[model samples]
Target: MSNIFTEAEIAYLESQPLGRLATVGPGGRPHVAPVGVFYDPQADAVVVAGHAGSGFGGSRKFRDAQAHPEVAYVVDDLASLDPWQPRGIEIRGTAETFSDGGEELGARITGVMPFDAAWLRIRACRVLAWGIDGDSFELSARDVA
Candidate 1:
């Protein structure tokens, strides 16, 4: 797929450290969590790092991604509280969990302590964005590639 993000979009993604990740559980229940993420320009993917083998096996998000590869992730913020201008990008894609190659995927985005973890790689298939322009509020959607 050609790069799904424009220059501005890429900058925005790199600027943001946290994103809401949506995944479906084995029973088809939706789960959302705020996760530390980074945009991997080389892979053209969003990477989320989580504790390795935390509770039963791994994290809920990791298990959920394994059960259901389809997921949605969003990063948004209010530019102006007075005017209530909100801007962000929503990414829909397939996720793959990696434990063997997660060491280099460490996230320092939030200044969180580093630890051994598994990484979730979200390969963008579709992207939707809104309110990127300073003065105009518009929504745009496009398929990757």
Candidate 2:
């Protein structure tokens, strides 16, 4: 599907790193963690990378993607708690695990985080975003909106 965000908004979110990643466990449980991401404009997808050794539920998510591809991620800029300074991005998608092209994927992911050479890939299906300021929260873009 085409992205809901304008290229400008997408570029803003992509400029920030450290997003919260959400995945499902084997038992259909939800999992969340902070992660670095690489956004590919060409594919209109976000790729997340993690080391095989990190063992922080990434493996399970990768495995789960094989059976169920649904997933979500959030990127928030909380550097300033000032309500008006809040800028965040939320992404929901069908994920696919790809390992055959580790080197290439790693290279792309590494551009986001230098230590991300050992992770697998999760391609985002949808993305939502909002910019919050002291006065109000405006929807920049979202699949649901």
Candidate 3:
């Protein structure tokens, strides 16, 4: 669902620079990789910029997402190891790839990947967040649709 991210969730996502993206690979296997992730409030979608290398278009995550569409993304951190506190959000959604003309969005990552044509746009279907909205031990979950 677009424009469904809560204020807390949006803040959490925007504050983080990296996230793990999980997608389906060959033979229905799951694959996950570290991505340059961002929260696009205007589009209401989480964007993964292929800023790791030059071959982002042929990347496994991109191909897998293209074939499967369904994906999960996570951005989290230990707020305090001493206090045993963890904070994070997990997003479940369908991904769509923009083959070209993503220079504006891709520009979010400067000097990396050189404004390439490959990127994944994930529109959330479900949201699960913790340690940022309610009791740290309680999960805040909802279906975006």
Find the candidate with the highest lDDT and give its number.
Answer: 3
Per-residue error at 135 for model 1, in Å? 5.4
Answer with 1 or 2, whichever has the higher TM-score.
1
TM-score per model over all chains: 0.85, 0.71, 0.89
Tens-digit per-residue lDDT, 11-85, candidate 3: 777778789999999999999999866776667888876653566778899899899999999999877898888
Give the distance in Å from residue 88's predicted Cα in candidate 2 to where it truly belongs: 0.6
- Which residue runs of candidate 3 sit more than 4 Å off their true CA positions? 108-114
lDDT of each: 0.77, 0.60, 0.81
TM-score of 2: 0.71
By TM-score, the best candidate is: 3
Order candidates by lDDT, high to low: 3, 1, 2
Compute the lDDT of residue 111 as modeled in candidate 3: 31
Quality of model 3 by C-alpha lDDT: 0.81
Q: Is candidate 1 or candidate 3 better by TM-score?
A: 3
How do the residues 1-145 of candidate 1 rate in per-residue lDDT, one tens digit apiece? 3267887888888787789999999779999999865777768888877543443127798889988999999999887899778999999999988765554445443334443556778999999888763342788888984
For candidate 2, write residues 59-120 as lDDT tens digits: 66666666677788787775466544667777777676665554465555444333323444
- lDDT agreement of model 1 with the native: 0.77
Cα lDDT of candidate 2 equals 0.60
Least accurate 10 contiguous residues by lDDT in model 2: 112-121
